[model samples]
Target: MASREFLKILSSARLGDVLAQQKLAEAYLTGAYKTPIQPANALIWLEKSYFSVTNQELKDKQTSSNSTTEILTQIARIPLAQTFQSPAFGFGWTSFWQLAHTKAETQLHLAAKWQLANLLINPDHQEIQAQLMEFLKGKNISSSLEAIAGLDLKGLQKIAKQFLQELAETDSPFTSAAKELLIKLQPKNAALSSLWISWLDDKNEEALLQAAELGLTMARLTLGLRLAQLDGGDTKSNASLKKAAYWLELAAKDGDRDAWYALGEIYRRPQFSGYSAAESDRCFDRAADLGHAEAQLRKGANLWRKREKSDEKVRGLQASYWVWQAHQQGIAEAKELLGKILESCPDPQKNDWHELALQAEQAINHHVEHQLDEDWLLLCHRIVIANQFHFSKAELLLCEVGQLQHEHCVVVDIRWELPKILPRLIQIETIQQRRALLAAGKVFASSDLEIEGNLRQRRYRFDRVTHWLTTTFAKANKHQTNTELA
Candidate 1:
């Protein structure tokens, strides 16, 4: 039986209100406000609460310069930002900064999980013991034990692991913390020890199978690839490949590029009875997207081969983009193919390339709008990205933040704003270009569209901002021309 106010809070929770959800979860867990004690229902709301909190944090950070600096710092640290990671790492590191804010109550949600992870790894950790005691005492004072359990022991570990895993994937201090806890959480079994030895020698089939079953992604990948490469004439080859595909598919879902490439190879093996070119190509495409260099070359060649006659320019642009990526990674074959590609695919620039966005951003120093109006601030960010991407005025004004992004390009289609204007795909060529795109996309995704207005209204707003930018650039150019003439 629920009270009217309790049902109202539940309604708000269902509508994605994090604070409301947290409140309901607390009330349910502790039997607060005469609500029935139900740890399972509490876990349900708590999960929703954390996820919603994350979404809200992102939305809030969209307008913060602190967030921008943090994001840029993270992106600039990636090992292969230029070729392998155009925009993929851009999205990942941007998501790294999670909910660590001034709100003490909301933070307890994460703190509790962090302590639980610590305690899971070291059951006698005195610091964690103190922290957990403080947490349970602070939040409604009882039945926090049931809240952790979600009414079962396995459920508690799953929740803790999931929480830590999400933290580990990001580029925050929590990432290392989450990773350390997760590593220790793995069972200290004979199978795991055997799997460690197999990494170097790889002869122990029984050891590999046990570790793969225990959910080690690298073990699955190693075993699957080893199985995939077995002689096709073996009587068990078909079954081995089938089993290889199964394990490789699981590893691929975990974002292992090697697993994706192996799956591609297995599917394309001519001797395999269940061979499917379409499926093989799909796997290769995914592998290429994940930054496997050889897969990029294969994907590029495949695209070149299947290019549509009518849409040659578009298809060729797309193909050459992948081929160009492979060429950059010292692929000799890709370099030869790129020579052919360049004949059909003209260079993307008419003028020598300049990072004018970086210069313009420095000149304007427009981040101040963060203190003024968040919408205006994001508009400034979008303008910087548009300049970086070499967007035309119309494209800059009309492009949807999220829709235009591709692996190698941003699709700028503004026919909805001006039917006479055609759409185009602009290449994302630099780490800086990817950085700009991530910045704009991060902000604009959370902006209020109705407040931003219709296309015509947006155009007027763009024109207003465009005036100052043009004036500044024109002045700079005129000065340069005079200096050159002298």
Candidate 2:
């Protein structure tokens, strides 16, 4: 018989008690309290009980066919069928594919499953190995047994081919996943074959640039690094650095703080013949504005590096803010600086550095669990508050971030842009017989920016912006949701 206490705990858990639910699940899983082994009973009870329990969502709202139909009905009532009708269905494996590419690890199991399928279909592909390696290297870890799984004869043959190629090029015999796979594939040949080194020469600038422009973030970082090296001072030195800086700027604009550090280096040298510290400071400030942890630390150090002691001292609070942000991002130098700053100030609660430090730490933890920080929300609020100003790009970003937050940061004013507006007009005009001139090109987002009747007007379209935001945040949401279910 189940103990009275365990039964009470399970009942409470079903009534929305998370801790109780966890305890009950653990008890059942472990066969505690002299319970007989009962996987079937445990699975059934846990599934039903957990579904009934109230829980916070960290992912996008999952759509069952039933729920999706209901949501579409409610949306139709808003008199904006065009806006309400979406192209893609709710979270599915395709969505999972898009998210795993972005390294948003809210749903490890789902991501792993998607990755497995991808590898299976395109076995022995170099691009796949490279992508996996890049993701792993960023995390400072190696070896993903989950990435390579048991397959049938055909699959194994394909895997063997791919594994041999990877091992041939990889340097470290034991540590390199590719090298290890090669051993498994061809034990005799593996010892005799020369290690592969030509893959390093696979840098294609045009492809990299194209990927960066399309918002493949790793591509942006890679392009930036390659440009930073100036790689033996080729004839294309200035062009290389400038292009690198531009891409880095875009990355920084997209909330990448490390890009700012790279920006600082590019702008630091007069010999590089680029922007000055003051000019670079703008980029750094922009980076800091977006919570780039290391960017914050470097901006502070940049002040001291330039011998701008007065400015540095005056901006101590701001510097400390970035320092704390850096510390939160795991920058060792920033952490040491923050420690020294805190020791000198000795304030219990109100120290600016201390407060910012706490906020930064909280922000990282929130991000890890697929939650947006309040600071990001405030930035979105600033955009919304500018309803009169109407920067469509800013509005689009708000909507994008809101995907994870579930309309938390969405501003209602996004309906004003020409890109968004033109579509609505087309839908309505089809209902009414509109003139050909009225339909000619009908003000598009790329139409123009102009002043109209005392309101500052700009042509904005949410098409690309909306798609980008949805693709990115939907993935994040799905990841979190899958994690919860797992």
Candidate 3:
């Protein structure tokens, strides 16, 4: 199926035409001229072409010691001089000594050395193992041995060990690569494990990456954390974040609690990997289930905040349940929130409610006596206002304040008639101040607030809100005073 032109070129190349040989090599290498892609055949033809050109050049030069010495010096400067030195050139060196009495340094000699080395390293050759050993012992051909270490051939463990021993004997440019190859070829062992850990402790990134790629869970998790902590907003930083996520996810799949938590944190930040609220929640929930205490508290808080916009009563219940779980595990913030939820339960007359209320009272007293700060006192008042209103917007405001702990001022406009002494609309900063203005209980204590709009935008009656606030604040004040006396 060969074209006439291709056959003509092949015929010319086989007849020792150097240009035709080079062209034929290119054709085979690239599968041009309707030739089959054959890398080995291409290297063979290229070597032939190179040698043919070198022979003609030598024939044109004067057979003088000075000329031969100049050519040898130039050959020594070839970038691959270290790679192309071979024991096969021993015959050529003897011939050179008898003639010009100088070391062999022709391009033909160099090309043959490199081509043979490349062919031996190409794993497809059946006798590569033997050839590799011979080449390693040959003159200045250690670079070829290094290339053999990089090949993914089976039964190279012994060869790799030899490389390690030789590399350890002296410093060389190939030492680091040799070490990596030896590690890859050898089975994982305690000594190697210790070595890798030491490398990691020394902040050797290449070693860490190699260990991670070898499926070390801890290494993967650590690398992920290191990548995630890289500070920047540039393209490289984003790429690092993605890579961090990949490793963290891998570790998490292997049940790494910290990886799960870190993944959750990363997913929550939109700039890092594009935010996915659901994915963030899922990761946090998984971490919490794995007994990550911070994750537990964060999951609970996220659920609690989401309840305001969610119409499902189960969502609020789950929020309380998680907060209680976190509290039982000794998270201070969760304990505070659990107490607030129990004490502010809408139906306090139920037996279950009464029991929870007692627990809440004890928890709140403990918090106030031991962990109370001025900021906490202000936060507690805000919580009371948010609970009394039972409006989504108010709950959102409380969530924001809890998260940020910044000063917030808001005005409530109530469309209802009130006593001249009572203000229909109020601008307030703290729940305690609102309680003071509604202490009379003439309006808010009697009826439920009429609210409208979606859950996030619902409004409430002025009297009903004030009544709830007055009752809640009074109970809180009494409980605190009693606890102090006790």
Candidate 4:
């Protein structure tokens, strides 16, 4: 049931109106104006509209070129009129006419071609397949595959297999999708499958290597992993490492995330691949970009570690972005790391503090429900420290502070009278304990030095404690300093 307006547009379209035909085609494609969903009708209208635009452009090109150029110059110099004079003088009329007389023909051609390919799904139609092949000759393979997938056609497995094989031979971003399709098409008793099975069952390394060389993606990754982890036969020898790297690099080129991550690990270990930090980071970045969660976490952690050593603000923000991405993807370890990073962040803006508090609350709730004892404890310490720095206002911070007070009350008392207690309190690994001891030391530093008879003994012990605490604070501050953005 087409609306009256749509009927009028279709009437105008049949009378050879290019705009009306294009509108009618859009209406059919979108089922607008109560039109039934008929892709065939859409394709027909699109083709008619495209040919009409092409005829008009050819007619315009046949006119005097000097006259057309002069008209374009005059149109470009004229500003918009204050009031409309005629429908022909409407806004954008000149530009629209120019575009339709020039570029619109090509655009319409491509649109019609895509719509036709999308509508034609009969694999038996040699004409349609030929048209598709012609259109896809120099186009992006991934986009072509996506258009084909939308057709949802049956009985085209052979054609699809051929396309996948061609894509697999190319070094395109769609290589992974092509490899996956190839694996799906592989027979259960294929030679590559048998070789992979043999290697899995009996550690037949040569069989796996042969299958890998035969373009089996999984076999390449498996053989690479096996070679990387090989023991007792010069495992870290240069030749062995180079061979492992070769296989891993091959798999990585075919868009295997695990292979990229494994290469990153190999390059990180100096004993394995001579320790190229830049190459390791690059591999980790590639894997992370390919949607590997572990790679994201590892990259984030390494960036944070490096930022500590270099005190670079850019690195800190980069670390936070990666860690936050991993956390959003539900990586548990990422949550704890992000919480600590946010807590130690100094002088963050209001919005940053708000986000930090929210993340802390979420981490606390998750760790409590899952009974992740170690993670919960670490987050608790981080929350308390964050509250000390005013980075967050989580209620769990108060609870942690109370627990620290109860556990270290005696140590706090001794720290005031005896400076030797500083080292013992600092030896405790908990962040809360160390922070409390440091606070108490500040209090002692501000007090009077009035002593009775044994001033020399007291001063000597205080000097030793002062020296140790100074060295420890210097080292900690060096590593834990806040990143200052310019």
Best by lDDT: 1
Better by lDDT, candidate 3 or 2: 3
lDDT of 2: 0.44
State every prediction's TM-score relative to the real structure.
Answer: 0.39, 0.27, 0.32, 0.34
**Model 1, position 295: C-alpha lDDT score:** 91
Ranking by TM-score: 1, 4, 3, 2
Candidate 4 residues 129-197, lDDT tens each? 454433433332223343343332243334445445655666655555555545544555688788888
lDDT value for model 3: 0.52
Whole-model Cα lDDT of every candidate shown, in order = 0.62, 0.44, 0.52, 0.53
For candidate 3, lDDT tens digit of each residue in 71-180? 33323222221222333333232222232212453433333333332233333344654544455455433434433434433434343344355553445544444444
Candidate 3 to native Cα RMSD, angstroms: 23.2
* 1 against 2, candidate with superior lDDT: 1
Total colliding residue pairs, candidate 1 = 0
lDDT tens digits by residue: candidate 1, 352-388? 2234444346434645642435655555666676666
Tell me the lDDT of model 1 at 464: 64
Better of 3 and 4 by TM-score: 4
